[model samples]
Target: MIGKLGATTVAILLSGSVMAAAAERVEVFSTSGCGCCIGWIRHLEEAGFEVTNENLAMADLYAKKTGAGLKPGQTSCHTGFVGGYVVEGHVPATQVKRLLAEKPDAVGITVPDMPAGSPGMGESDEPYEVLLVARDGSTSVFARYPLAEDASR
Candidate 1:
């Protein structure tokens, strides 16, 4: 009985460690002066993602480094990287998880133009779409969210 109990305990511990390692933390890059960016980081943290915020001036350069082609009117207050994907603007945490799980061919997700009801934007509840931006400066509809509704659903 003692040996069996010890084996069970070891199995449980190993499973817990594996679960923790599966959800890797995310890193976010945003300008120091942007308040909404901070809010977005908080949203990710609340969703169980470990977030690292880097405040820098050359956001355009950062975007380029992450394979996010800087396009006119596509830039936002912040950008993030997770599981080898670039997350731009107020992308919902659930969408980030989906990107990691689905492992699409594209670069990552984006929510252009601080739209209302996004993760950080403190505007009225309005519908928005998260675009899947590819490395070749192409984008397509990835996900859409309704007004005042959470993207996780």
Candidate 2:
């Protein structure tokens, strides 16, 4: 129970908001034309994250992503930063919170390509994986969603 709210009917409430307030705000970099990127932004907002967006050209965006030490296959529709970690693709806010909480040694987390069932990606009922790209460029499964097993490259 948070903010005088009961557990009952909590489904209609924004639990993410409670979690969001203490969470790190995110800085996003993406092309303004990508609808999925916008959706991802909305997802963050709904999760109670204070997100600042920067629209950059594809070349510039790619430059930033790579400059941040991101590797190939870890690329996604967009990039974001929270705390000291980079967030790539339509990563779930829950995972972001987990990442921040764990404070892992990594460049960031990525959902790979625009998997149909990913956060911003449209409905595909496909499974996907969120990969935590370590600082050394090695990768590991950070989190798994039954319907989210195919996203991370």
Candidate 3:
């Protein structure tokens, strides 16, 4: 009986740690004129993230601060900072959650050239790739999602 109680305690502690780690807050920087950015913010909030939205004229500055880069023609509507990770464009909340959970050795994530169904685009049924952007401005494919994959779906 004592052994069983000890095991239960350990399991409870492990579950608490996982829940605490997953309940991280996110900060999003976006232009006020972009409606899609707002939609993305909503997406994050719905995904159990405490999101704070900041409308700024110099989003590039925020991007640089968070170690996110913008490639010409690949730039999207907004940028986000979550768990020391940078997220660009309309990346899905699930991918962001995965990044935080995995804690990759890169700077952050990006989805260049915003797709229609990405988070915040208001169309959550499009396939897209979240690219892992490194500090040196190099990037690679991080995660892929099909259309209809959203925070709720």
Per-residue alpha-carbon lDDT of model 2 for 1-153, expressed as tens digits? 555666655745566655556457899999988999988888888777889999999999999889888888889979998887899998887888889888988898988888776777766667788899998988899977643343321
Q: After superposition, how far is residue 59 of candidate 3 from its true place, in Å?
A: 6.1
The digit string of per-residue lDDT tens for model 3 on 3-114 reads 8779889889889988775557888787777888888888878888888887877756455544455555445667778787777888878888889889988778888766
Segments of candidate 3 deviating more than 4 angstroms: 1-23, 59-74, 124-126, 147-153
Tell me the alpha-carbon RMSD of every candidate: 3.6, 7.2, 3.9
The CA lDDT of each predicted structure is 0.78, 0.82, 0.75
- Estimate the lDDT of model 3: 0.75
Q: Tell me the lDDT of candidate 2.
A: 0.82
lDDT rank, highest first?
2, 1, 3
Regions of model 1 farther than 4 Å from truth: 1-23, 59-67, 147-153
- TM-scores for candidates 1 onward, in order: 0.77, 0.79, 0.74
Best by lDDT: 2
Kindly provide the TM-score of model 3 when superposed on the true structure, using C-alpha atoms. Answer: 0.74
When 1 and 2 are scored with lDDT, the better candidate is: 2
